[model samples]
Target: MADMSALTEAEAANRLMRLAKLIAHHNARYHAEDAPEISDAEYDALVRENSALEAAFPHLVRADSPNRQVGASVETSPLAKVAHEKRMMSLDNAFDDAEVEEFVARVRRYLALPADAPVAMTAEDKIDGLSLSIRYENRVLKQAATRGDGQVGEDVTANVRHIADIPQSLRDDAPDLFEVRGEVYMAKADFVALNARLMVAGQALAESKNEAFDPETVRQFANPRNAAAGSLRQKDAAVTASRPLRFLAHGWGAHSALPADTQMGVMQAIGRWGFPLSEHLRRFENAAELLAHYRGIEALRADMPYDIDGVVYKVDRLDWQERLGFVAKAPRWAIAHKFPAERAQTDLVAIDIQVGRTGKLTPVGRLTPVTVGGVVVSNVTLHNADEIARLGVRPGDRVVVQRAGDVIPQVVENLTREEPRNAFVFPDHCPACGSEAVREEGEVDVRCTGGLICPAQRFERLRHFVSRGALDIEGLGEKTIQEFLDLGWIDEPADIFRLSQHRDELVGRKGWQEKSVDGLLESIRAKTSPDAARLLFGLGIRHVGAVTARDLLKRHTTLPALRALAEDIIALRAATEPLPDEPPHRFQARIDKAIADHIGVENVGAAVGHALADFFHEPHNVQAWEDLLNEVSPPDYKVDVRESAVSGQTIVFTGKLETMSRDEAKAQAEALGAKAAGSVSAKTDLIVAGPGAGSKLKKAAELGIRVIDEAEWAEIVRGG
Candidate 1:
């Protein structure tokens, strides 16, 4: 990590922006998708680095900081979503004993306890499984949900009914309205047996079809935690019933009445009510005793039936917990002391390049099958070309791999970098489509420039087109997209609208009934008049995210207008190049300013303009765009501006919002016809400040702008 103190404000801001995006991506993978690209240690390191930078440069914190987020959103899940009565927050992590000590000392300092005063804490194994919340009413189970983005979760009531470890009814003494929060896990033996069974089933099915079986094509769970999550999250309760799963209660969410004043007391009560509690759960009066217990649990981790990555320590007194409250997404009175990642040596047999949906080439190191943290590791992510160069890993080299948190396997070190052999070479052309693969300026990733032609990119692009944020075609999931792509039924976004032509054929296919076929076609047809901004975003254009698409559409009003502007920008750039005697930087700046002026949209700068221009410059892209437009007619983009005091005003919101997310606050401002700016300036009309309001607040005061609390802002909104 770079020295936080040494970084300039601009540098810190840039790093924070990158860190925020990186963390959000990883959070979505781990929380929502049941897949993680990086190990827990790597992810934690990114968070810690972000925290260090934020601490040093508090004023430069981005709105999308990882510190402000908990779990990822479940907007894309097929299951129905339910809002949690109380938020399901994550725990802060402590990697070393010193950090753990600091946590205890911080708690003591917050409560203003004397040095000798004991602070009782409960320590329990941090199970590496899916987080679940089971709600009960009148001692009967009502609903079960998987924590999704803290505030909301996917309803899994039917699935949980099949897990024997989870009781349908609590004891008569239990609270009538209680939400039991815990981890749903699969035992190590069951995980192994499950994988074996999946493999056998795949082989048997292939043989029955008189085809060769490819293990790579078979869906196997990455680890026990993933197996447990994938099993429990099944849409079919029958599938969940077939899996051997268990649950252990760790805490309670909303409750009608408290059964105990201390955390341990409530956990004991939960245990007596038929929910299993961790056997290693213990209460300690001081930091020393808690650390000792953590170490003891770490020692027994290998022998445990289920996977546990760390030990969670929480203040035992419920009153103290309430007093400590929460900072961002974690409680101030608790921390998870994590164990070191498990490591093993393996041979790097080969390096394989996989192209992602966005056309970035990722390198995967094929390793000689080895065991790490009780799981067989056949491959490890090399991340990209830069990582491969840094590790100096090539075929026939020994390497060290680790599975941190028993999730993703990563190559940490190369044991034979000094060996006299040829270094692995990164491809300069897309392996899938033979298109030129080049790294962009200031970027480490080598991406394919194939656009809509590459097979890999095409499949991913089609999948993204039907994603939750895009057209949201109900029955068109990744698997279904791949199946259609394989059968040559769909090739581009426009082709999806024409899928009804194959209705009869689709009905005859295995797993496709007449009702399902009709439903899928209906879902696709429903998007014929989709949201203009969503359709633009669904095109998977480079540098055009959902927000950017909305901003551009808001300015241009229609897709055709946006395309015309893009073409105009292209013409303008071609007509205005560096003069013969002019400096390159000066000429570049002039053209950039011209493009920005032409677009005339806040946050839509020269990068987006150039991306738009470059996209339209390609004849193939223009053809694709026209084809898509022919299939659908999106209405002109318009913001529903309500007449209000803030209408036609520029508003800047700073600090932490307690009741809503930053995006929600910004959307509310937009709804009120206010332009929500990130930074305060002289032209700002109002400043909605929350707790932790820092430099922006000072700036607003210096500019003599009207400032109000979140409650006041809410009143203005309500009145409007």
Candidate 2:
């Protein structure tokens, strides 16, 4: 420790306060935004500096100093108001192993226990995202909300309905009313995938620093935290459906139904109820064992799939927890030991631009493969144009990468000695398919014009087509699709139907045998006569996604009619182009609206309109449909469109959908005669918001739309 002989008490106090403010600001940006400008090392330095200053002037340290806090106050805009049955207090935090040990000692002292007090602790990765509450009634989901100031919160019933980890209808024997609390976060892989999709579609990037993440960026997502928070608040279920978000249950507030007398039992019971529980969590019987677990997790933090800033330790006994309740903004019964941020240096091999299925462009850094914990790290996702500009990173540059807890690897700094190229070019062509790419006005991503042809684009399109969102094809999954593609057993989606004829060939392939091939053929055959909406989506037309396909099929249910009308549709598109007497781009909105209007479902709006018009007007599209139709029989036509409180409702389900996967829910909605929309809107009748539902929910509630809980929604759908 540096000698502080020259520093006065006043000086030390002033420095400590300044350090507190700076560290708090950083934490807000990090925990709330999910975008960190400073390097992990730099952040660590700030925390260390703050700690040193506080240690020198303990009297000046505020009780609720940033150094001793678990999370910032919950965001308020989107969650609905509900007084917590038990206040969702924050946790006191510690920065290192020493601090964690000290925290344990303090707990022992407070309880007046022996030096070796057999106090147990459970160490869970402290997820760096928004906290949420999901309520269940009689083993069925009731209402879901966020923790806003530990009391009143904006209702995000729709958004909460999107996450797969959250059970839509609980199958547990716990209580009449159960309110499970967890962190609503975007998985690193999902975050990467989401960014990819947005880039492919030429959408905006989420905002980073609230101030820096501007609308001018292609998609305008606020960091993962903001994005996740925004997604959970949507009133229009469809909007929340667009984001890639997830929920990991950490603790709870109220569960008058549970007989279990401990938090561990509560978590285990819920896990048994089909809730997605964290696998890394553990129960410890002693403080020493808990510290060991914390250290072990800290060592493996770099390999975690989600961001974790710290580890939460709570009194396992529910009775004990109740006895040692709230102290100001935090709970006296629990504490969080924040692990120091760790960094590693790796060689940046190349910076490449990737075009996603939606046409949004993104930069990815290809790095020399290194093991951060147990996982191999060969690449790191670089968010957008502004991020690239800020990092000053280039191909062949040596860069510093940081991973906190088991979160995805992030490039913190570029530190190459050699002067490199000043900038990396954002590609103007689809790297996978050579299509002329363009960035939309006010957008940053340069997207590919070739929607279906690009390899990456094709894979994504195929995935979506067969996804729980589109045709809901079973057995034909990502691996199977890639395998079939490589073996030349299938090319276009139309080939899926033809696979039945080549069952012998499929069975003869490298890994497949008679049984597997037969099962695969059976699955394909089952979907051969898929519904008109499924057929429309499976065709892989640009702008004509699941909802648009369903909307169009509602008007023209047969393939021949859809094909016959293509020319006229193209002519209509020609009339709507911004250019004089020129045909609108195949993906133009006016044309989509014209089709929706002429076709019906006037509810079909701008985005779907553009998507459909583009798909229909493409010259090759008609032939593609003709070919697919000739091979496969469309499913028996059923226009089961239901007119409900949000009738003619168009909903999109993104991320892991609760109750059912996204595809099942969408198919079910269509089966009910409701138009399943791809994005949220003012006209949306109801949003079946599930867990991981993000910004769309916020927008919906902001519009004063009625958002219902999943259970109430099920009742409405069942005509209760």
Candidate 3:
């Protein structure tokens, strides 16, 4: 063995600093916000790297190195203080399919149990909420506290008291003191409804400038776990009570109420004592049966009402559990064998078009409701008409639904064997407003010709207008805005900001109690900082995507500048109507070239300019802008984004990449400063041609696009 006795203090300090930053970044993604930058495998690699470094240079590890810690360090006031009898240690997590399987094998090996050993597991929704310890004394619920620092927690007895599901007084036949710890999460339905209610009443909403930003008002939880944590620590008990927060017991930190012979029995006894234990948890006798149970859990995850991060596998015998004990933070006897986050495979029954509040017709796939990871995902998004056609999907076909990372659910494949049920015909009329749908040339999506009169477009437009991305309206949703629209509460977008005149009408609605309506109206009254991008996107201009919206905002920086650009485009078009003698194809090419050149200066293209011209040329479009400007002011933003990394860069990725999957790599490049062209082109920056790269490779050579393998791509990201 190496001596390892000559480590210096200075060297150790540097190591500790790096570990702290890495762990902090991971925690920020994993706890504060739901979106994580790294995949589970990448995260595990970092964790292992940190762990190895700590072990090698033990003196360098900080007290707060993630390898040695669990839970957040943030502290809040106004909660009751309760010390944990046993530390509420966090579990060791597994990210993907292989890690989960590995965990099962390791557990069996360590237990000295038979190859076909009898074991059991509990799979429950890993609620994206707060964690709390509710203590009971002599069967009477005494106090509840937030999971502050594992050692101490703030008292939340009053707010806990408000949760009807949590028994205030346990059954008489109980032990002296008991503690139950679990997550408190807001239901999706409840959250949606609450947002809707807020919108109906007309309220202001908060916006996050950073994707990593976690706000208090928005249940913008990092995941089910963080959501639960935030819900438990509200300063006001009434605010906690008002939230649709509920608790489900996963396990106990300390308990004297049930016999410790078996954890299953303990769970049953806990449930008998009025704790809300899930009915879906199961026990298995052998590894085969355990694996089967996991599959069953995976299958049932979507149907279940709550969100589950993964499945928990544990040894059945309490004595065995005692023998196994724990290693570091995680219990040796129990491992959470989580299923890959909520996924579902269903028949892509049909593709249906939905006219948005902006009159943009979006094609949505209707599927058999199958649970993928945990959520009952019945409808996978088809994005736009272009995607549906590209996928070659039609009605009555089986499709695989997948939710990769935090990205929305999408149809991955056409798994159906049956073919040729009539082709999906794009609708000509807006289903919501009955406005004739028009697909402009050289564009992907079809838009409603109806403009504002279409109810769907009107409603969606209003919502988008008040949306954080647009106008940042605090309290407007489909329901409330629809109600306002139906009741003549507001017609034009400006009317929302000027709703004081209809104060009497607003308060008279069925759900609009005086206090709620007043609160909502007050929230709506506080909107002054509208930005140029927000206003532009709010207008629902077709082909002017989110990126383009931001670009326009940055370039113009003010409403006046944008108005001038619009006027220039309008005048330019008026002076140059299509030449009658000009060949249609030649004229189209010339128009495309001119538009491309203009937008190219700002890194935009022909499509965006044409879209802007179309909107500005219309009189109604000008009126909408004027109406918006009257009520809101545009924010100043400096346009200084470098040409995106993928901009004009053609990259074709093939085979499996250790860092990211094909689609993921594509998405990352697109998100970063680059352009991910489908095929290799002369403009290609680098062809990330992986193993099994076929035609793309041949094409790349022909086009003189530089081809590189996966290793090269990895090197670029690592700054090698």
Best by lDDT: 1
| Candidate 2 lDDT, 431-450, residue by residue in tens | 77788888664244577877
Highest TM-score scorer: 1
Q: After superposition, which runs of candidate 3 have C-alpha atoms over 4 Å from their true positions? A: 1-17, 28-45, 48-63, 76-81, 95-125, 202-229, 341-720
Which run of 10 residues does model 2 get worst, by summed lDDT? 203-212
Model 1 over residues 119-203: C-alpha lDDT tens digits?
9999999999999999999999999999999999999999999999899999999987999999999999999999999999999
Clashing residue pairs in candidate 1, if any? none
Which residue runs of candidate 1 sit more than 4 Å off their true CA positions?
2-28, 49-69, 72-80, 101-120, 162-164, 189-222, 235-242, 284-289, 317-320, 474-524, 547-623, 636-720
Candidate 3 displacement at residue 106 in angstroms:
3.9
Q: Kindly indicate the candidate among 2 and 3 with the higher lDDT.
A: 2
lDDT of 3 at 322: 58
Better of 1 and 3 by TM-score: 1
Listed per candidate, the RMSD to the true structure in angstroms reads 6.4, 21.0, 18.3
- For 618-648, candidate 3 gives per-residue lDDT tens digits of 7887787777678776568666546543454
